[model samples]
Target: MIAKLQIQLNTALYLRDPQSTDLGQKIVQEGIYMIDEIGFESFTFKKLSKRINSTEASIYRYFENKHRLLVYLIAWYWNYVEYKITFETHNISNAEEKLKIAIQLITSKLADDDNFPGISESVLQRIVISESDKTYLTKNVDQINREGLFKGYKSLCMTIASYMLEINPAFKFSRSLTSTCLEAAHQQIFFAEHLPRLTDIKKEEKMYDRNCEFLTSLIFSSLKS
Candidate 1:
């Protein structure tokens, strides 16, 4: 998670408009697309400049370096996710519906064709696995943590727990279960890589839909006394 944290930290640096110019916004948008395509290791200012029809100097004028550009991209992704989730699921009234809608929204978003393809499993493992040892390299660790990804995750869990509670206030909503749900949402995308033995279900979009359906059923059924 260290590398992931570092990337998140770096991405945060570009959250604002440095010059309020059209070029700056374009740089941010195109940079995200490029990073999603090529990834942080292979992505460079020159490549981004070429992709966006801008000069390397122009990119530098907004971002200090490639790492900073990446930080911005990560931030943008999270911010977009937060907005999407809030807007899509906020209208549901019941806890069960809220939890179900939240999970559906999360799964749907991850399944989106436009999500950053540059973030491969190897890269994610490198970030999470190496987090402790490489913490110092990421200057924006505190800031990224403060950005509320984790908090947002916890809130989702609380929402789920609230729904579960509605069924039976005694139901134990352990941290493990919350983490399981969160990981399950992510696993829906990379299940082929993460759980190869679990059947190549993700290759079929129908399977994802079925899985979501089954997941909600299981959660609701399990909550019943």
Candidate 2:
């Protein structure tokens, strides 16, 4: 039912929208897999070009560099999550319930959404969990922020923070709490899978459920305090 939703993004993110044409779409579809297979530091456009059977010049036509492409994918993910939050919680009246649902969506393991035909959200979520910080951790983050490249992330945080205020208007750290929960969900999941000693949660088939419970408790308890 949510297939037709359009995710508007910052124009500065790409030289051309990768969703616009077949070659562009192939670049994105394969790029996600390539990035997931190889770490982002090793993910060069040359490798991507070889994988997609497209020339580097052609790939560069859609993106100024691989960093921009990474940002584009990150932005797409943020917008997609925001779309899901709005869709799933629209009918619920209770603020606490809405926030709870939002927590589940953000913290749980992602599955491929049939609505987005070519994109694998399950794989994309791993990118977001592992590589999202790279998008803004650079020295040029200030310049890129001014270009509105991070608006998707900022908007998603704002949406969640609004729910926080609904439950507790006096909570002064809604934005901080929202951003922390978002990062924590990803960090805890990563730690569970790769570095077990760093997190209390055990790695298992349902590890994400433990991560969700941890964040939900952290958020609600902090709000109640």
Candidate 3:
């Protein structure tokens, strides 16, 4: 069992910090569960308020809107991912091995961690796989980014990109490569379940195992060039 995880995100993500109060935490916990149960396109704060038995006004106090709430949840997940990566790889001195460990952490099947009793990491992982793109695929992305809405994602990506450089100092496009690895980890699992035609993984092989193999080959091959 993982110990209690305390990930502090940027204050800009919320109007009222959810971790500061019980009602606020309920909004976040239920929001994650509902978004995963339904889909982001159909999620609303009204529905979320109903789930937590709080008025819409109460939820609005915590978040400007459900979109910000979603961003908050996504940010928290990325923070958790960074925490896991550090925990799993910090002791390893080998860059190749560190990169491999990082890939494994990102691609592995997510299991619930009791440490975070509010949000279900397993369910949140599903939301990330499906709804994460929505967080940035908007016309106001620049404005949102200017407000540091994507700091969590960007921070984690930079950490991984740094690992990429450790493995291949001469290789350019480390950031692109790092981002691609993150996207591929989510996209391939999504494609395997919903759009099998897009991926080459065999039916008998677990998606995580296949991705680990493919990414290992891809990362190593690129570094050798």
Best by TM-score: 2
Each prediction's number of clashing residue pairs: 10, 0, 0
Lowest lDDT sum, 10 consecutive residues, model 1, at 1-10
Residue-by-residue lDDT tens digits, candidate 2, 80-194: 9889999999999899999999999998788888788778899999998899889999999999999999999999999999999999999999999999988887888888888
Provide the lDDT at 172 for model 3.
93
Residue lDDT tens for model 3, 98-180: 88888888888789888887778999999988888888888989999999988988898998888889978989988888889
Candidate 2 lowest-lDDT run of ten: 1-10
* lDDT of every predicted structure (CA atoms): 0.55, 0.91, 0.87
**TM-score ranking, high to low:** 2, 3, 1
Displacement of the residue 78 alpha carbon in candidate 3, Å = 1.1
lDDT score for residue 16 of model 2: 89
Model 2, position 225: C-alpha lDDT score: 100
| Per-residue alpha-carbon lDDT of candidate 1 for residues 147-192, written as tens digits (9 for 90 to 100) | 5424444555665566567657777753455556555654544554
* Candidate 3 residue runs with Cα over 4 Å from true position: 1-3, 202-205
Q: Give, for candidate 3, the lowest lDDT window spanning 10 residues.
A: 199-208
Candidate 3 lDDT (Cα, whole model)?
A: 0.87
Order of the predicted models by lDDT, top scorer first: 2, 3, 1
What TM-score would each prediction reach against the true structure? 0.61, 0.96, 0.95
Summed over model 1, clashes come to 10
